[model samples]
Target: MKSWRDSVRNVVPYTPGEQPKEDGVIKLNTNENPYPPSPKVLEAMKEITNLRKYPDPAVSDLTEALSSYYRIDSSEVFVGVGSDDVLAIAFLTFFNSDVPVFFPDITYSFYDVWADLFQIPFERKPLNEKFEICAQDYYGENGGVIFPNPNAPTGALLELETVRDILDHNREVLVIVDEAYIDFGGESALSLIHDYDNLLVVQTYSKSRSLAGLRIGYAMGNRELIKAMSDVKYSFNSYTMNEPSIVMGTAAIKDEEYFQDTRNKIIKTREWFQEELRELGFSFADSKANFVFAAHESIPARELFEAAKKEKIYVRYFDKPRINNYLRISIGTDEEMQALVRFFKSMMNK
Candidate 1:
């Protein structure tokens, strides 16, 4: 009998932070915005009552808005489900058996999982002692390069100059910057498209736009690079993205004022939360994102997370080595933060 199975055996799925269904726990495991999406987005989505017809295959309107925002040509953009899809496309279009891809060892864990799923060989280059991506070490002969700016968990930012240097020095290599978290604080590589044809910058409306549930993301690059990823997406699922998402995302971009206010609130909350954590004898990475990475000398990250859950507050804790000592707490509303702090203080006093 012929066996029917996939090459899925060796692949280990990426584990996102624990999300519990209990209503009492303050959900902060995923780095989702604590605020609601722009009112305009909700209005836009409501207009899509007819589900029988298909969405625009090209997603022309949303891409046009993104094109103007990033100041790139429309041909240089490809809209997809999320930044994760854009990254998965990058893996399919660029990574190959001929040469291995390279990324920071401590970067978004999903990158490694993507490589394994595609059977693409890859190597994890260790970040510098300061946890910055070492451009010098990345010049080795490889298939392509990919990493996140203001990387996940660590929340560290790589300056634009450093990113440009890496691109210039490795001209032949395809460089993909996952900018999912960059909008919160870091500079975007969307500005480098003119100089580097091989640079692919991925972005999501999930973060700054407070549209995590909308599942809208796009990529910017030279027309050819964008076209390559499109081919992969088109082959598998031509209309994978839905009509309501497009209507909502396009409207969200058009309403810049609401987006800014929401982003500003998140930034304010992040800064204030960082200060409060510091006062509680915690040390952590200098965050350049919507989340704060912190740890106190007295409490283990796992224990802190468990204790917070008991108080109906939940934050993220990765059991991975090195990072196991730290918790990645998403910046929530001021009241939510105060509640978390109050619980921590009471736990300590007890």
Candidate 2:
């Protein structure tokens, strides 16, 4: 419609993984934590008595809590509704120049959407045949750079040295390392943020802390970069985090014991499932995230997706080139994963 702004009208939005609400459907499409949040978080959420006032524009409590947990200065932290919001604001705040930003051809699908929506030039540097990012490919000139550590869907991780190499090459332009799944089993680039002025490392509590429902994500970077992001956030929306989310997020970060227990459980389950897939003749990358991207030796990924859906099981299937044959299966509870293994065994043997 001509009534709409030209930017909104021409944009092709990012498609997230499906969220099926029906009972009995084992939801594993979105990489959400299958475990419940800490009891302390639930208790804190129940204490949201003040609904009359707006949340803190600065998101003070959660920011302070995250700062303490990560042992970083509060000025170096920025919080938003989710990593999506943080990343979106980042795209707007930075990536303004005409020079093309660079990322993996098979990385988080949202990167391209953000670039297109904002009219920022970008190039998708192809990953090697092994689905691993080549740090050298990101070496040349660019406006900005961003990629997921343990890159999504494939879950292939670039070592810390490789990450440092890319940062070394792109010192002038902004570099964002989206560590959305880093809690699963990968070294975070957060340690490099202190050294690289251009580095901004983003993470979410949705996975490890089991706070997806709270919708809180944060970034750690140099004080200057965080100030720019904060300015953009305030200009767009003064109050992003809700009272309940802030309180609950603060409580979740404090429950270190529960967080470690749940994360360890998921990692153990992922390792066990990886062995099961190997025995089933499936080929996959060594995923460090809480998901497994694997392809069956005989059965097509598309067919497996459909068959699993019929069984009331939902797994992520990307209908894109180079990765269409693979299934991105999020690690569910031990019992849920075992059920999936049994189902795969039956279907593959048949």
lDDT of 1 by residue, 1-350 (tens): 54656533766788876767777668777888889998988888778888899988989989998888777799999998888888888888888657888898878889889988888888999887666788887878888998899888788898999999888777887999999888788999888988999999888987788888889888899999988888888898899888888788888988888878888888888888888888888888789898988879888889998888777787887778667888888888888888888887887873
Which residue window of length 10 is worst by lDDT in model 1?
Answer: 1-10
Q: What are the models' TM-scores?
A: 0.96, 0.98
Write candidate 2's Cα lDDT for 96-155 as tens digits: 999999999998999999999889999999999999999999999899999999899789
Reference-based lDDT, each prediction: 0.85, 0.93
lDDT of 1 at 85: 84
**Among all windows of ten consecutive residues in candidate 2, which has the lowest summed lDDT?**
1-10
Candidate 2 versus the native: TM-score? 0.98
TM-score of 1: 0.96
User: Cα lDDT for residue 200, model 1?
Assistant: 91
Clashing pairs in 2: none
